[model samples]
Target chain A: MLIFEPHIHMFSRITDDYERLALAGVRGVLEPAFWLGQNRTSVGTFVDYFETLIGWERHRAQQFGIHHFCTMGLNPREANDDRVNKDVLAILPRYCEKDSCVGVGEIGLDDQTKTEEKFMAEQLELAKRHDLPVLVHTPHRDKKKGFERCIAIVKEQNFPMQKLLLDHGNEETIKITRDLGCWSGFSIYPNTKMDPARMVAIVLEYGVERFVINSAADWGVSDPMMVPRTVVKLEQAGVPRSKIEQLVWKNPIGFFAQSGRISEQMLQQPARANLRETFDGNSVLRGQDPDRV
Target chain B: MSRMHEQLATLLGPAAAGADAEFAKVLADRSHLPVVFPGLPRRLGRNHLGGGRTRVGDATIDLDAFRPCDLAAADLLIRCEASDDELFDLYQHGDIEERTMLLRALHVLPVGPITVRMFGEAQRTNMLVHVEAALCDGDLFARTVGQPGFEPDVANRVLLKLAFLDLPLARCLFAERHANPGLSTMLQDLATEREAAGRAVWRDTWRMIGLAPTAGSAARLVGGLEHGDDGVRAAAAEGLLALGRKDLFAFAEERLPREPRADIRAILQRCLA
Candidate 1:
C-alpha cells in the first residue's frame, strides 16, 4: 500500500518523521510552502526557506527513501503580510520551475481578508502562468464560509477547477465541492477538526473520487502520520483497499501531474540517496561519516 | 440533444429515468460545463456499461471503463454550447476520469488543428489510464496520424507504448489500417530493443510486421512461426497471413503439428484453409 503524503510540511519536522513515514509506506510527500510559525520579516527568509524545501529538506527525505516534492507559493497568511508578499510572489515563478516544485499553493484565504484575497489571486495568476496545480489552504475560522469564499474566488477568476485542490475541508465542504470539478482535500489531524475515524465515515459515505488527505504537519501541533493512520482506519472500516489507495496515492498524483512534471512512472522508484551529499556546504548528518551514518 | 445522445439515453433505459432531473437541470445551461462535468459519474452512477461499441470523435471506441450513465452525461458535455477553446480548457483542467470522458467524446467537438493538438497533448501523460483513454479500444489515432498540427508523431509513439505495455495491439481499431513503413520499422526496432534488454516482446508485433513486411522484419515473421512462445508464434502467423504470400503458407503448414497452443494452431490452420 504505497502512499503519497500529498500535503505535509517536513521543513519544520525532525528527521525521524521522514524515517517513520518511510516505514509506514509513504513513498513520496508534497510539502506546500506555508507559514513557518513566526512570520518572517523579510523576503530573504522566504527565499532561503523555499530553497531549503527543494534543497536540503528534499535531500533529507530522500535519505530515508521517501520522495519529497514541494509547492512554491506565498501562503495566505503571508499574503496579508505586505512586507514580503509582493517580493515572495516575484520570486515564486522562478522557484516554480525547480525540478521538485509541483504546484503553486498553500495559498488561499487565511484571515478571510481582502488583502489575503489580493495576494491569493496574484499567486493564482502565477500558477496560471506556470500552468501548475494549486493547493488552496482554506481558513479554519468561520470554516464553512472560508470554503465558500475560496470557491467563489476560484470561480470568479474562472480558474480551471481541475487544477484546484481546496484543502482543510470537512463533511460540509464535501457537499460544496463534490459537484465542482476541483479536487477536494481533507487534512487529517490527530484530534479536533478531522481524525481517522471521521475520515472513514466520509469515505464510506462520499466515496473516494477526486479526494486527497494530508497531515499538513508543520511547526505547530499536528501529526505527520495522519495519512498513514487514516489508511489503517479506512481498512478497519472495510473501505476497499483500492479506494483507500486512490485517496492517498492516485488522487494527489493525478492532481499534481497537471503541472506537466511528476507522474506515476516517475515516482515508481524512490529517488537515489547518497548520505554524503551536501547542500551549500551543509549536510543533515552533522559531521557524521557518510558511510557510517 | 443529438441523435447519439438520444441513443445513449435509450440504452440506459431505467437508469436514465432516475437521472433525468439532474441531467435536465445541468443540461439546461452549458455554462456549467466545467463544474457539472466532474459530478457526472456520481450523479449518473458508474455501473460498468456493458454492450457494443460507441463512437466518439471520428472513431469508434469500446466503453472499456466508461459507464453508460457517464457517456450519456459526457455526450451532454459534448453538446455544451461552449466553443472549442472552452472545451480545450476543460480538457486541460480535467481529472483522469473527466479527461477520459472528454477524449472519448472528441468526435462531437469541433475538429481542426486544436482538436488534433488536444489528442496529441493527452498522449504525453505517463498514467496508463490516460494513455489507455487516448489510444486503446479506439481508432482515434487513425484520424490524426499525419495531420498538419500534430507533431513529433505521437500516434506511432503511442503504438510503441501499446506494445511496451503489452496491451493487445489488436485492440487498436485501425493499427493495420494505418500501418505505414515508419510504424513497422519503429515496431521492429522496439522488438530488437526488448529482445536485447532480455524483456518479453509484444507478441502482436508480428501482426504489424506481417502487414508491412520488410525483408528483415518479414524474415523475423517467418522465424516467428518456429518461436517457442505460443502467443508470439500465433501473432507471427497472423502477421504472415496479411502478406498474402504463398511461400509463407507452406512454412506454416509444415509447422502446424508442432504448434501445441490452440490459438497458434488456429492461425496455422488459417494458412492452409
Candidate 2:
C-alpha cells in the first residue's frame, strides 16, 4: 500500500501540512531537481539546492516516515546562461551518484531557444556519461519543436531510449515519446499542469507502462498532497490495485533504486531521530537517521 | 510552361530557369542521395518546399529539377535545389534530408502526388507515406497544444503578426495597446509584478517577451538581482540582458567580484560580456 511520488519539489512548497498525505498512504517521493521559481544563476546556488535535495529535503519527508530521493540536472532556463551552464553541467556528473542521486533529470528544453537546444545536447551527454536515467523537460511553448528536437538530439547522440524519462508529457507528447520508448511523466498541478482526472485518462489511453505522475510543486501554488489524491482517484476510477502499485511504487523504485542510491533493505528501515541531522546533514525530518528512514 | 520552369525562373534567378527535371534526375542518379518523401508541408514564401531546399542568390530550385538516380542503403540521402516554399513542396512529395540544408525553404506547400518517408521507432526503419500540408500543420499544431506552454492564439498574434512588421512598428503598436503615458514604465511594472507573484512560467514568458526592451523592465531587473533566491537573481540577469542595457554590464561585473558561487559568477560574466 506504500506509494511513491516520483516527481515533486518539496522545498519549493511549504509541506508543513503534508503529514495528512502520510495518513493517506504515500510512503516515498522522488523530487527531481528543477528551476525553483525562475532560474538559478550560479553553480554554488545549484550546489546548495542539490544539497538540499539530497540532504535536508530527504530528512524533512522522513519525519512522516516517507523516503525521499532526487535527480539533478541543468534545467532548461538555467542552461540559457552559458556562464553557469557549463559549471552546472560539470558538477552534474559528480552528483549523479546511484546512492542518494536517482537520475539526471529536469533537463530538456525551455523556450525552444537555440541555447536550450545546445544545452539539451550536452545534458544528454551527461546522462550517457553517468549511465543514469534522464528526465527531460519539454518546453512550455513550441512543444512540437521541442519534443521533435528532444527526440532528434537523443537519437543523434545514440542514447538508449529506455533510460530517458520525458517529463511534462501530456496526451500528445506522451503518446509520441512513449512510442519512441522513453519513459513518460505528467506533472499534476492545480491548473497549469496535469490533473489527477486527466492523468487517469492518459493511463487508460496509454496503458500505464513506462508512465508516471508527479506534483512538480515548487515556488508556486501547488498541492503537495496531490500525489496520494491521484492514487485515490485511480482507485475510484476502477484501475486495478496492481496497476496503481506499479505506477506509484515499483516503477519509480525500479528506475531510481537501480541507481544504487537505495536498496530494498535501506528503504524498509524504520525512521530514527539523530542529533547531527540539519539542512546540511540530511533533508528529511530533523534528527531522523537516513539508514532507518 | 512547366511548373519547374516557372518556379525556377523566379527562385533561381532567371539563369536557372532553363534547368529541367531531367537535371534533377541526373543528379539524383549520380549522387548518394537519400530518398526524399514528397508529401510533407512547405513554407509560405519562395523557399516554400515539401521537405527542404537549396538557395541560389535570388532564386531557388526544387529537387525535382534534377534527374532521379539510384542509390545504395548507406547512400540514402536527398538533395534539392529549391526555395523554402518549393522545398516544402518536395517534402510533401515524399522527400527526406540526411544532408545539411539539402532540402531548405519548403514549409507550407500543399501535398501532391508524391509519398513522403517517415522514420518510426517501432520499426526502426523508414516508412513512406503521403501527408497533406494542412494535415501536417494540424498534426504538429495539435501536438504543440499539448506541450507545456504553447498558446497558438498568442503565438500567432505575437510572433506571426510581428513576423511581417518592422520592430519599430511592433513596438509602437505595443505602446498604443496600453494607453499609459509611461507605457514602457507601466509594462516594466507589470512584468515585475508578475515575477514577484510567482506567476506560472508560461504567463511570465508571454508578458515579458515584449516588455524586455523597456527601461522600466531593465531597472526592475537590476533591482531583482539582489533578491534572496538564486532563481530570482538568475532571472534578473536574463531580463537585464534582454533589455539590452549595456550599463547593467558594469553592475553585473561588480556583483561577480563578490559572488561566491562558481555558477552565479559565470552567469554574471556572460551577462556583462
Candidate 3:
C-alpha cells in the first residue's frame, strides 16, 4: 500500500500529521509552494518560505519516513500582489534549479488576475527553460473555467502537455483535461474539494490513465489522510489493486520524474528516520524521550 | 505531386530548389529520417490520409515511411528563412496540418501587428488547435494587449470564448494582462445567467466575483455560501474572505453552525479570522 501524495502543504501541518501520513502508508509527498492564508508583505518572506520548503520541510518529512519533494512558484493568490510578486519572480529562476525542487507550480489562476496570469506565464516559461514538469493549481471557484484557462495557457506556451499536471480537477474538468492530453489531478479534500466517494466514481468513469489523486492538505481543515482513505474507497468499489497503485504511486512518480530529479529507485529506497534528528535547533519531538519510542 | 512536396514548395519558394536537392539526398538514405506520419491516435482519423506512396515531381516518395523528424527538419528549414508576410500567407491558406504547424512555429515567425491581426482572425473561428496556437505559443497576444490600438471588447470576447469552449485559461496569452473590470463583469453576467438557467457555470466565474467585490457580487458570494454544492459554498466563502467584507461577517457567523462540512467551516472561520 505504498503511496505518493502529489500535492500537500506540510509547512502548515503539525508534526503529528506527518507521522499519521507515514503510518497510513504515504511513503512520499510533494508539497507545492502555495500562499499562506494571509498575504505575504515582502519578498524576504517568500524567500524564507521557499527556503523552508526545500530545507526544513524536507528534513521534517524525513523524520516521519516520508521522502519530501516540492515544486516552487509564486502562488497565484500572492502573484496578485504587485509589490512582492516582482521580487518573487526575480528569485524564482534560482530556486527552481534546486535539487529537491521537482517543478514549477501550484502556479496558475486564483482570481485569474492580470498579475497572476503574468506571473503564471513567466513561471511556465521558467519551467520550459528548466525543462521541468509543472504542477498547475486550477482556480477553486470557477474550476471548469480555471481548468480551461490553465490548459489554454499551457498550450500557448507550447510546453509539453504530457509534462503538465492540471491539479484540483473535479468530474467536469477531468474528461476535458484527459481529452486535451494532459494529466488530470484530483485533490480529495475532506470538504471543499472532491470527496473519497466522488474520487472513486471518477476513477470508475475515467479509468485511471494518467489520473492522479492527492490530498493538497494545507492550513485549512484538509485531511492529510485523504489519499489513503480514497485508496480504501477505490478498493471497496472494486477497482483493481494495480490500477489503484498506478493512481496512488506510479502516475505521480512518472509525472514528477520528468523533472529529472525523481526516480523509481529513489522512491523505493526507504529514507532512514531518526526521531532524534533536529532541524536547526528544532526537533520533531518536544520533551518526549526518543529512546523510549 | 505529394502534399508534402507542394507544401515544401510553397514554404520555400525560391529556396525550394536547394531544399529539394537536400530532400532528395535525405530520401535516398531514409534510415536517418523520421516517420512521415507519426503514430497519431486513431481518433485523428482525418490525419491518417496520404499513407503508403505518392508522387512528387519525379520522386516516387513512400509517404508512409517518412521520418517524423524529417517533417520537423523541413518545417525548420522553411520557417528559419521565411518573411512575416510569407509565414502569414502560408498560415492564411494552409491546410489544417500546415496551419497547425505554422502556429506552432509562431515563435520563429517575424510576428508584428499583421501577425496579431491574423491571430485575431484565427481566434474568431474558435478552432481548438488554431486558438491554442494563437493564444498559447508566443507573446503575440500579450504584445497585442499592450498595443495602443488594442480593444478591450476583443480581449473580452477571447476570454468569453475560452470559457464557452472550455479551453484552459492557463494558456491564454493575455488572460493575466487583460483581467480588467470589463471581463470580470462579463463573467459575472455569464455565471448569473447560467445559474438562473440551472446550468453549471465555469468555476472561474467566482474569481470575478471575488476580484471586483461589488455590492451585487458580494451578495452573490453570500448566496453561494448557502448553495447546495459544497464546492460552490467553499468557493463563495473564499471570495468573501478575500473581499474582507465586514458586512458579510454576521451572515457568515450565522451560517457557521449549520455548515455541515469542516472544509467549508474552515473557510468561514477564515472570513472571521
**Clash totals in order:** 2, 98, 27
Q: Tens digits of per-residue lDDT for model 1 on B1-273?
A: 576556656666666764565556567755545545645554566677766576654557676655654565555654555566776775654544566666755644445575576666655555455566666666766666677765435567767778866778767677677776777888889889989999898888888878877657768888999998888888888888887788768889889888888887887788788
lDDT at B248 for candidate 2? 68
Q: List the residue pairs that clash in candidate 1.
A: B57-B106, B57-B107
Q: Using lDDT as the measure, name the better of candidate 2 and candidate 3.
A: 3
- State the fnat of model 1: 0.00
Q: Supply candidate 1's per-residue lDDT for A19.
A: 83
TM-score of each: 0.57, 0.48, 0.52
Name the runs in model 2 displaced over 4 angstroms.
Answer: A15-18, A263-265, A269-293, B1-273
Model number with the top TM-score: 1
| Candidate lDDT (C-alpha), each | 0.77, 0.55, 0.72
Residue A157, candidate 3: C-alpha displacement in angstroms: 1.1
- Best-to-worst ranking by TM-score: 1, 3, 2
In the order shown, the candidates' DockQ scores are 0.01, 0.01, 0.01
